[model samples]
Target: MDDTEILSSSEQKMEDASTESPADAIAVTHSSDDSGDSDSDSEDEAESNHQIETLESELSANPYNYDAYVQYIKLLRKTANLEKLRQARKAMSAIFPLSPSLWLEWAKDEASLASSDNVPEIVKLYERGLSDYQVCSLVYWKQLLE
Candidate 1:
C-alpha cells in the first residue's frame, strides 16, 4: 500500500539496510513489539499501567503529596487492571481515608468482575459493597442485589 509500510516491512525482514536510523528507529523498535503491526500492539497495556505503578512507587519513596494521590486515583479508575486497583485502593484508604469514591469504585469494579465471571466470589463482593460503598446509585445496588 503505502511506501512507509513497505519500507517498515522490508526493514523488519532485514532487507532495507544494514545500518539502523538513530532516533525514530529506536522508538519504533522498542514500541512496535513482536506483532510487527504496532498499531494493534497490546504490550502497551503493561507499559501504560507501569507508568501508573511507577508513580505510586515514587510516591511511596517520597513524602506525602496530594497531587500524587489524585493522579494515582485517576489511574486506578482508568485502568481495568485488578492488581493495580487493589494496590491503589489500599494506598488511598491509608493516605486519604475520607475519599469514599475510591472505595466505592473499587467495590463496584469487584462486583462487576464477579458478575461477569459468575463465580462464588460475587457473594463476598456483595458484602464488601454493602460495607464499603453504600453511596452508589440505585443501579449499582440493583446489580448487587441480583
Candidate 2:
C-alpha cells in the first residue's frame, strides 16, 4: 500500500480503538451520580485519558510519530493540562524543529499565558519558530505579528 493508504488505515484503527468501551480500555471511576449526563461525561473523560495514554505509548516507541504527538497535544489542551501541554510542545519542537504548525501552536499557547516577565520567553519561542520556518509560509509571519 502507498503512504496515504497506510495513514488512512492507521487512522481508522485509531478511531475504532477510541470508540471502544471505556471499561475495557481505561478504568475511570465516576461519582455516585447515576445520571446519564454524568455517566456520559465520565466515559468521555476516560476515553480522552485512554487516547492520551495510547498516544504517549506510541511516542515512546517512536518519537517521530507526529500524528500521535499532535493528538496528544490536542487532548492535553482540551483537558486544560497546561503544564503537560507546554512540555509536549517543547518536546515536539525539539524533535520537529521545522514544523511550523507545532511552533505556531506552541507560541500561541505561550502568548496566551504571557506576562511582563515572560514576554521575553514568548518572543524567544517565536524567534526560534521563525528561524526554522521562515520561508515555509506567511502564516508564521502573521502569527509573529499578532
TM-score of each: 0.46, 0.67
- For residues 1-146, write the lDDT of model 2, one tens digit per residue: 77798668547645744443322222222322333447655786789889888988999999998788888987776655667777888788788864776677678767766777988888898899888865756777787778
Q: What's the residue-level lDDT of 60 in candidate 2?
A: 92
Worst 10 residues of 1 by lDDT: 16-25
Top of the candidates by TM-score: 2
Candidate 1: which stretches are off by over 4 Å?
Answer: 1-50, 115-146
What lDDT tens digits, residue by residue, belong to model 1 across residues 97-134? 43444444555556555545655565664555555555
Give lDDT for model 2. Answer: 0.70
**What does candidate 1 score on TM?**
0.46
Point out the worst 10-residue segment of candidate 2 by lDDT. Answer: 23-32
- Please estimate how well model 1 matches the true structure, expressed as its whole-model Cα lDDT: 0.56
